[model samples]
Target: MTRFSANLGFLWQDRPLPDAIRAAKAAGFDAVECHWPYATAPGEVVAALAETGLPILGLNTRRGDIEAGENGLSALVGREDEARAAIDEALAYAAHVKAANVHVMAGFAQGQAAHRRFVAALRYACDQEAKRGISILIEPLNHYDAPGYFLATTDQAAEIIAEVGAPNLKLMFDCYHVQLMEGDLTHRLERLRPIIGHIQFAGVPDRGPPDAGEVSYAHVFKAIERLGYKAPLGAEYKPGGPTDDTLAWMAAYRP
Candidate 1:
């Protein structure tokens, strides 16, 4: 069966994280994911999840100094300690929330120095989280949307994962970014299946609802199921209007 997770990061931005979890549950999401949830108390998040009976799929490491325009901490060349701390913080929060995965964000950086830092951070993260049984994920953002980001392609991420050589490390494959950056979505999915830990989607270019996207989600979802992907697909898109208004597409794929 194909399951969906409401991305509380973009959806229900008007509400608090706990309230957003409730909103996702009310809207019939099978699971929930968030971009960052450090501001919300883990107990409150746990309470919401308990009440709603919806599991949190995952959460992301902090993007350092957002006011300074830093997108993440992991790959920045001189910030190894800060990046490792961010990983620890994310893992700690995920432990409290019982989230299965944590995305270690690779902030804006480039070249060999940035790659070395990213691999080192992942090594530390993987070693620490192995005891907790939580998976560490790396996602490649599209350059158009995330200019100058260090990780900008699926192949780059795959190579990093291989170089890191951690069993707990995996890929967070976002279909929206993949479609925009590299159009061979199904082929990439198949090739990266062994390392893919999660999947997400939104409309290409517009970043809206998935049903009207340039890529056909119907075929994509079917391919995912046929490939034996058991994880819930994260709906990581901006709503066209109110969050609820963009959910008509859910009726078709979500039971």
Candidate 2:
């Protein structure tokens, strides 16, 4: 059965982290994925997951120095130490919370320097996480929403993943970003299925809930099923209205 992971980052912002976990379970989500869960106590998050019997599928590495305007550190030239430290911290937290994946944010970077740093960061994280049975994910944010983001296309991500050549390294395929960056979602989904560790979706352009989107997720979901993907599809979208009001799509998507 297909399952969905509520992205607490964009959903349930009105509440605390634990409360958001409970809200996701109540909303019929089988699992939850958060942007950065470090602010709340790990014990509290663990307790919530235990109570709800839902897995925390994944969380992200901290976006580096928000106050300094660094979206992330992993790909920044001359920040290898900071990037590795971030990876270590994220891996430790993921281990504590029993999370299966960690999305290593690439930040705003460009050219060869950034790419080299990104690969080095990933290699270090993959080696560190493999022993714990965890996977490392890299996502490509579309240029429209994230202008200077280091990664912006599936082909680019695939190339980097190939270069890294780590068993634990994989792509975080976001359908909305993919559609926005390059249309033909189904073909890309099928073509890139091997290297993809997790999949996410949202309404294109607006970044809203999945129900009203240029891409027909009905067919997309069918293609995912046909391709035999085993992981849950991450719902990482901003709610157009109340989060609850935006979930009519769940009734049909839930197992």
Candidate 3:
């Protein structure tokens, strides 16, 4: 079976952390992850994992620590200091939770200077974060949902990862975004499997629960299994109903 990670950010937006983890486990999931565990302490995350015996697959670094009103940090951003600071804080959070990966958001930083700044920052982030035994997973956001985002396609992300040539840096293969940009799911997965550091998804176009959309994840997983992908398949979708309503998807999703 393909191990699955519930994305708490989308499923339990109003519930406590423990409740979310417990819910995932109750629904027969083995792990859980989220975008940001806002206001939730790192100890709480560790304790939740302990209580439910479920691992947190990963989470994002504090996007500007919100209280500081800082925007998200990505490699393509123009602010070197901000991007570096974001990486440092993310390293600490990962250490606290003993996480092996962090989704490094490369938000919009355009123009010649912005492009140059992003390239340099990516190199610095990988070099600095490698000390913790954790790697930076770069994601290319879609043009529709995240307009002006710097890294908007896997091809571009793969190019940058190849250029930086860091052992700790790799591309995050988000199915929804990739489907929107490229649509060749299985073939792309086969080609990019080597550089892929993490994978996530939502129903394409709508970003809702998989069963409620046009993207047939059952076939997708079957194809992924054909390639022998044994890692967690991340459930990073917006719940169409209650979080538990998504439990039915697992019944038909075979690896």
Candidate 4:
């Protein structure tokens, strides 16, 4: 059976992170993940997860200086210090919360210099967090949603993972971005199965609930199961209305 993880970042934006964790549990989600939870005290999040018994799958590194239009820091050529700081902060927070993975964000950058910087930062992260048994994730953002983003395709992410040469380093295969950037989801999933650390999905183009989308998640879910991916897939979609109102799709996946 396919299990699901509510992405607290978009699922319950109106509530506190702790409250969102509770909501995900109540909503029958198997687990939960978030974008940036730095503002919320790790103790609060830890307490909520303890109360609900829902494991947090992962959380993202802070997007540096949002006001300056910087999406992430690790890939920018001149921001090595800031990038390492973000990585350190994320790994520490993940450890405190008992989370399993950290999605290292690669900011808006391009060129060989950016590539080298990103690889070095990822190496630092993988080395630092390996002792804790935490996996480091890198996701490819679609060009339409994240222009100039350094990592923009599965091929690129796979190549970088190879270059970094870390067992704990893996790819975050978000279906929405992959479908948008490179069609053929099933084949890609098969080809990249070994390196896939996590998977996420949303309605393409709209980024809404998965019930209505260009890609059929029902079929995709079957493919994922066949690929032997046992983790709960992340439901990282916008609700369009109250998140509760958008959960009708969950019934189809439940017993």
Candidate 5:
């Protein structure tokens, strides 16, 4: 069976944050991930991990306006200091959670300076994270979802990762966003799987649980496994209702 990581930030969100970690563990998930344990301190996140015994597969630097807007930090044009701060905070958080990867989102806005700054800031984070055994993930949010962002494709992210040339710096493979931005999922995954430090999903079109969504997770997960992907398949999606109810799709595939 494909190993799965559920994002507790979306599941059991109504409860106190740490309890969400326990909830994902209770759901039989192999790991728990989050976009932001923002208000939740590193001590708290680490404590939750200890109590639940769930590995934190990954997490992202704060985008700042996810509740009011959708543009992420890496989407910005010339705010390298901001990126550094965000990455530093996330790195500390990653350390506490013992997470392996931190997804970097370029802030949304257009300017050559932004691109340069983004790269410079990324290199800084990459250097620091390397010492801590964490891989810094550079994710390309789809243009529709984050217009004006500097990097918006796997190819672009690959270029930056190559330039940075750090073993700890890599791209995040988000199946839903990439499928929405560009198609040919399996072939693409095969082509870029090497630099991919993480993976995620949501059904295409509706971005719901895989059972009702457009992407054939059965096919996708099979392809991923065939490619020898060894990391958790990060379940980063909005719940259809509550977390457990949304995960009922996993039942149909029971062994």
Candidate 6:
């Protein structure tokens, strides 16, 4: 059976983070994930997880200076200090909340210099999280939604993962981004299965509920299960309206 995780960043925007966790539980999601829970106390998140008995799968490192159009810090040439600080902060928070993975954001950058910086940052993050049993994930964002984003393709991410050479370093295969950037989901899933730590999805073009998407999630979920990915897939989509009204897609995949 396929399981799903509610991405609280989009699913329950109106509620408090802790309340959102409870809502995900009531919605029949098997697990939960978030964007940045830094503002909310880690203790509150941990308590909610305990109450619901649902694992928090992953969270992202701080996206530095959003006002300045900065999406991430890890790959910026001169921001090594700030990048490591974000990584440390994320790992510390993950430790407190017992999150299984941290998606280290590689900011808008290009060329060999950016590549070198991103690899170095991932090495540092992977080393720090290894003893804690936490994995480090890198994701490729589509150009339309995240123009100039450093990580922009699965092939690029896979190459970086190979260069970093950390056992815990993995790829976050977000289907919405991948479909926009590179089609052929099932083949890519098969080839990248070894290093994929987490997977996410939303409707193409609209980024809404999976039930009304260009991509058929029903078929995609079967491919995921066949590939032996037992972890709950992340539902990282915009709700379009009230989140509850968009969850009819979940009924078809629930165990």
Per-residue lDDT of 14-50 in model 6, one digit per residue for the tens? 9999999999999999999999999999999999999
Cα lDDT of model 2 by residue, 188-241, tens digit: 988998999999999877889887858788889889988999778999999956
- Candidates by lDDT, descending order: 4, 6, 1, 2, 5, 3
User: TM-scores of the models, in the given order?
Assistant: 0.98, 0.97, 0.92, 0.99, 0.92, 0.99
Q: Candidate 2: misplaced stretches above 4 Å?
A: none
lDDT of each: 0.92, 0.91, 0.78, 0.96, 0.80, 0.95
Clashing residue pairs, backbone N/CA/C < 3 A, model 1:
none
Tens digit of lDDT per residue, candidate 5, span 19-49? Answer: 8888888888889888877787778878888
- Against the true structure, what is every candidate's RMSD? 0.9, 1.1, 2.2, 0.6, 1.9, 0.7
lDDT for model 6 comes to: 0.95
Q: Could you give candidate 3's per-residue lDDT for residues 92-165 as a string of tens digits?
A: 88778777687777666666666567667778778877778877888888878877777888898888888888
- Checking candidate 2 for backbone clashes, the offending pairs are none
The regions of model 4 sitting more than 4 angstroms off are none
The runs of at least 3 residues in candidate 6 whose Cα sits more than 4 Å from the true structure, single-residue gaps closed, are none
Note the residue pairs that clash in candidate 4: none
Judging by TM-score, tell me the better candidate of 3 and 6: 6
Off by over 4 Å in 5: 65-70, 74-78
Which run of 10 residues does model 2 get worst, by summed lDDT? 246-255
